[model samples]
Target chain A: MARVVGSRLGVGLALSVVAVVIVALLSSSTRLAVALGLGVAVLGVGATLVSLPAVRRDHPVVTRALISVVVVDLAVVLTFRVSATSNSNVAIGAAMAIVLLGLSFLTGSSGQISLGNGAFMGVGAFTVGIWADHHATTPLVVVLVLATVAGALVGLVLGLPATRLRGPYLAGMTLAFAVAFGAILNVFSSWTGGDSGLQLPSAVVAPHWLASYFGPGASTLTTSSAWLADISIVVTGVALFLMANLFASRTGRAMRLVRDNDVAAELVGVSLPRARVVAFTVSAAYAALGGALWTLVNNAVSPSTYGFVLSITILSLVVIGGIGTIPGAIIGGIIYAFSAGAISWLTAHLGLNPQGNVASQLDGIIFGGLLVLTIVFAPMGIAGLVRHGWRRWRRG
Target chain B: MDSFLTSRNVSDLLGGVTSGVIYALVALSLVLIWRSTRMLNFAQGAMAVFATYIGFAILAPSTNYWVSMAVAILAGLVLGGVTERVLVRPLYGKPEINPIVAMVGLLLVLESIAAAIWSTSSRALATPFSIVDWQLNHKPVALSPFALYEIITSLVVMAIVAGLFQYTKLGLQLRAAALAPEVSRLLGVRVGRMLTVGWMLSTAVGAVTAVLVASNFFTGLTPSGMDGVFAFGFIAAAIGGLDSPVGAMVSGLALGVVFQFVGDYVNSNAIILVALAMLIVSLMVRPNGIFTRSAQRRV
Candidate 1:
């Protein structure tokens, strides 16, 4: 008992040192510095308090402490630094979070992987884009709702066939659907704006009470970006929370049972096909919802943007974010979102792009290397690593 | 309507026959990989494109198209053998998804490498054959020498592959290995070596298809230089059975006819759409392909 307490105290002290270094790095502008420092101090104290139980032999509390610390850090970043005011990237990221949550809910909870996520996103985006284009007078909420419903319906239809197939067969079938969708969308150019893409109306704020909070002298931010980001994050968070809770419930148990052993599930009087269909339907809806959220933010759609490459990237996101974890999806999204910009920035910083053909081809090499390395080294992805660290810390 | 008759179609179907011959040749490459590895080599078209580009680089100083074709096929042989040895060998016996993902990575890597290795500039390739006039039903029907060569070469290659697979001990060993690698290994067959040979042969076949078709229609080179032929080839292979060489030939020809006449008669833009629809139908009705047995899941 004394040894456990000693180790926990040691870990707490080490984390505090790390926090102090981070604070020192970010200690620049007065307002930002104070905010970040306070946040870190609060997190340090909270971590110290959370570890007390772990020091006394409650092993699970260590995970709880880690998750809480991460949650707090994310909250601080989102609230303080990543201003929803006129920040399109934040809005896009928030929308992606919802989609990721939905995907994690459907894929992780249900034992299925989808390769047609890009297509489903396309459907949602296009549906809303068309609605906004045609009914310029319609309320933004109505258009979004309609798009969501339409996308979900289509998702259900696509998922129907998938109930019978699993693993690579299912993925292959979805891939075929996605390819066909891309081709068909390209052919039906007038409807989907062809290869050029369809433009959508920017999301309207609808003049909520939250917009009034900035006050008279405040730098005005677009009501739409703020409201949309909040709504998407909140809705997606709630949906995912419900999904997680459901997984901890009987329905999730049944799905997991079906996934683990179909014969055993069948013997238990569970309708294997029905459970699969339900899981598929739910997953498709999540994809649709994510797509609609994506359109709401982009306010435009392109066939080329939602093709095979996008599908592959989305699947990569799910893979890299631990196949079955919600936080993993968010982490994966953040990584993907930043990776492109970081690579471009690094290339620019080194004057690499102007360095001729070698510089230009580096992007491909990097991406290929990333794929190979991730598959070979971290099969369970970033989430798996996090879990591993958390376990080690607890043991220590 | 009169030309739709089988014998008459044979005469008026010169264009279709030429295109189909090229498609069948490419489809043969697809089949070789599918038969041996049981995985569709989606990178086949991209590989061929790279080989053709290499050939183009080699032939840039002169207008010797034959030498370019030969050199490209040889490059294809080397490339296929090397890729299988290095990248694909590790992926064997793994889950199908792993290979698919790896192949997608391969496709991207190859495209990026080709773009880097060769300038992104589109080059117009010259064909060895000249335009010629032929008499059919008292009408002056024009037939290019390149198209005629494609047909002749395709037939010859088909015969060669058939003979090699049927009669030669090497062919027997390859078949044994492809069907059951364990059994073949027990029977003293060098399965790994056979796969390498298979890869080389398939890649060479792809190279021939690339040079012949690219020379005929797509003289320009880019990342997507051989994309059209690949699309048509995939359609042909899908239409025919993925496993049957004969089916590949017939389906390639059939797809070519559909593209030529349907685009001529209907909206030319609808050709791809129609092809996609045909593929969807084929997949639904005969997912094992028109010639191969239905695929069975392991577990």
Candidate 2:
């Protein structure tokens, strides 16, 4: 126990030192917000390291949350100091990670297939879009909350009947919803903003106090977008932390038991329907939260963006990034973010037309191949593969 | 007023029949796979779209519709065989959901390949037969030539499939292999080859649907042309009992007419939601399927 605590304390101190190096590299002219962020992260790390021996064994989840908070705090400040484009890129990645987390929980733990999560996300996005159309003055937090509630309601309604379904039947319903999303959007064009999509009346503006802090006398970070990135990171961080705890909770265990063997789960008195419904509803809420955050980064929502292809892509990425794991979701999101850039770059160099179908579909091909390979070779995904390799190497 | 009602009602009915055959054709393909593997081929739509792309390529150079269709079916046979052998073969005896997910991956890969070769732009395929609606007393009341072509083709294919399953030795072996692989193997049924042939025949059926639908029912030969059709067919397959091909045909046609009425009377956009509702309600009410008599669960 002493040795293990010593190692964790050493790792925590090393991370804090790296955090200081990153803080120093950003220069003194950077935001006081950055310094304040650094101070908080370091203090958190210090506090957690001190509490490691006490809480490490008995309250591992608390230990994990503390570590995650420190990581997120440092990341928020680092992303804030980056260029506007990279900041926006990070923001998009963060939002997608939240969505992937939802998928990982539903698919990885509960073992339900959902092809309509894109549409569910659309439910959240359009909540923001349609709500803003009618009530432009609604506070962002209230709108986000409403978006989540809207998604959960939709999930509950859909999930209740779906709980009785298995495999193809469940997938069939979700696939139908996904394929029909565009048609549904077109029906209420006035509210959904129709084909053209809805633009926020204003960009997601950081508040004045935040602007003053983030502006930092024009040290290269655009005030609002960077602040938006910061907000996105925080939201993503909270999602990560919450999902992690859920995975370690009794409900998560029940869902997993239901996934592995329904008969066994039933024998244990776990209500199969309730477990399935809870997984479905919770997954939908996470997707909605991710979608609501997307509005912050993109400032617009379109029907075309939330179609069957997007849904498939989301699933494929989850599988490729390692389904059913929190780290897998984040890894998948990062892979998606980077691969988009890489594909565009490769297509440009290869003389492929950007608007051409082949160039557009390159990512699909890569992800699809990876998905098939992952399922066959490493059912747990890239994270599983890495984890396996790490364990083998450690033994060697 | 009487003429107006008859004209609209008859036209909608004819239209429903036309689309219903298309759905039945797709449902037939799905039922074929499900009977053998107990797996839903989510890539069935994408595979159909691919065969259509190949058919379009053939028809583009020469305006011979039959020749293009023959070649397309041949293409589907080869593609399906390859898919079953390479991609799907590894997934057997695994979790039930793996096949579905892998097929989704195949769907993406196949659609992407189709797009890479033919592009995603929509284009109309030329129908050898005319599309002018047959009329009675100066009011359109029946099927057009192309619509008739679609129904006749589907009927012929359905009949041929039924005959093959009932009368042929190969079909008997295929059935035995799917029904009892261990016993069939002991009896020298060549279970592996049967599965490959099963997929080949199934995709050929889907190919026929794709080629025929390109005449009147399908929008155009786009990469996503058959995805919507796939969903409706999935509903039909579920209603028909995934194990029954005959059930697929009847339920598919019935669903087509009912789905048409919903689109015609209600908002057309509501069609998908209606499809989803039908699927969910049916799955909940009769998980074994409406057309099925037995409610046996396979472990």
Candidate 3:
């Protein structure tokens, strides 16, 4: 009986992997992939829960961590469902938050500080927008892939020279890259709308059948919202998976070693500059991929969406989430999205005065407070704090 | 616009510089903060905007613009000192990014506060000094009092600041503190207090620029009035080298002149693009800035 049960579980996992691969290849619709991703995410959570009892006896910490994540995911899904009547917007928000989280996790863990995400996003948005609007010829999947590739190439070039610079210098260089890219876009006003940004096409959504399936009770959700949720879920899930896989790889280990001590890493046969470049490249790809998705959702990409403010906000989210941890990034993204969405909703529904419109300046206050407070009190970040609490609970 | 520029090309160039000088002042203020704390005060522009508004409010109650200007400067002094003590003091020994993030936060707070308090009405600030047209070398030259003040005051401030830093004990101490914080601490120097003082002084300088620039621009400065300053100042600061006070002064004037020429020749917005280009070139060719710091890494 035990052997049969084990075989069945293995088959389930194998089938899930096959399904994922199939989805990745054949799907042109971001919405479909997003829907599939959500289903898989749910399945993953459910399976993890089922496995918890078995793991709890041997690897309590791992089991507990998994359970905690499931709980967090539940909270997020619930909050998103409550706030957004449509699955698409919620998905989009989730996807964006997830992408940011993944990128932050990669960056913080790898010891890289880049503000080039803004630039990468700009590139992706414009590319996708142009391809979709002008040619209307490129398949959706093809466009997304192309956007990521372009972003990656740009990131790689920027990363090559930039990796040589460290700390503040690298940060400054990335910032320049972002600003310069914006300027270039403006200079070519005919194409990019110069000071007046170009309009993006309307966001494409999931097919009606798929939307109805997952959004069973989502009578309140709009078609746009459903589509957004679907795409966000898929992209975020995929990015997280890739990042997680990377972290478990030899390359990721090497990157971490380089981050901790470049001199020591060099002594151990790691090329510090190469590692930095690799980290940067990975980060760039993530940003670009995320940017593509963002444009697809907004259906209108502009320069203003990806500026210093967005870069800073991304940085703040990462820091707040716990800098270098996967869970930290995810949680941080959710918190940010929730706070931002809530403030915006409140401002509109309650008809608050502009002065009280926390959304307008809430970012500054929250990030500012978080930064200062984190430096002083929680230098290890939210993930680190969670780890600390878990250890304490176990000890007790 | 072309005819307007064609007729007053020289004067337009001068006018751009006159405005550019204000950017230089704000940039100079940024340099002071960076030198002392190795962190760019992203809030510097916002702080100046806030101070300028306060000056405006004070002047609003009174008819005399000069009196209002004095009151504004004083308000700036107080505001600068308080900001340093409350927001900056905690971030003194933290990692570099901490202060930057905090400053971003401070930026939000200041802008929001301003918006909340002042509402969104654009107040047309009265220029304290009127424009006077004077003939120079067979050409009519238009000179505004604000222009004369900016040129004169910037030069005077530069000279006085240079003298103070080069010759004074406080300057010596501040330099020592910036270069070797641990040694300075060991030497019984009040490094923290000195930093606070640096913030206070730099903020006051920013206030002076704000009022002057606002008066010249003839509009109540928005949260963004100082944005152009921040960007241009960064250029000047970089070109001057982040570490050199004299370099800042020269770079500021040079930037002013460059922008004037750019404004005269290219699109006015092109000046900002030029500034952005300057940053890229400087980072590539001379990351230590034009002044060339031999000791630092040039990445």
DockQ of candidate 2 compared with the true complex:
0.72
**Order by TM-score, highest first:** 2, 3, 1
lDDT of each residue in B67-122, candidate 3, tens digit only: 76677777777887898888788776665556665675576567666765665466
Q: Rank order by DockQ, top first? A: 2, 3, 1
lDDT (0 to 1) per candidate: 0.68, 0.82, 0.67
Q: Residues A38-147, candidate 2: write the lDDT tens digits.
A: 87567758867786766677667767766766767677767756777777877887888888999899986678889888888898998898887788877777888899
Error of 3 at B124 (Å): 2.9
**Model 2 vs truth, CA RMSD:** 3.3
Q: Candidates 1 and 2: which is better by lDDT? A: 2
RMSD of each: 6.4, 3.3, 6.0
Query: Residue B259: error of model 2 in Å?
Result: 1.7
Candidate closer to the true structure by lDDT (higher is better), 1 or 3: 1
Q: How does the DockQ of candidate 3 come out?
A: 0.26
Q: Write the per-residue lDDT of candidate 2 for residues B127-232, one digit (tens) a residue.
A: 8998887766776756788888888999999999999989999989989988899999999999999999999999999988887766576476788888888988
Please report the candidate that would top TM-score against the real structure.
Answer: 2
* DockQ of every candidate structure: 0.26, 0.72, 0.26
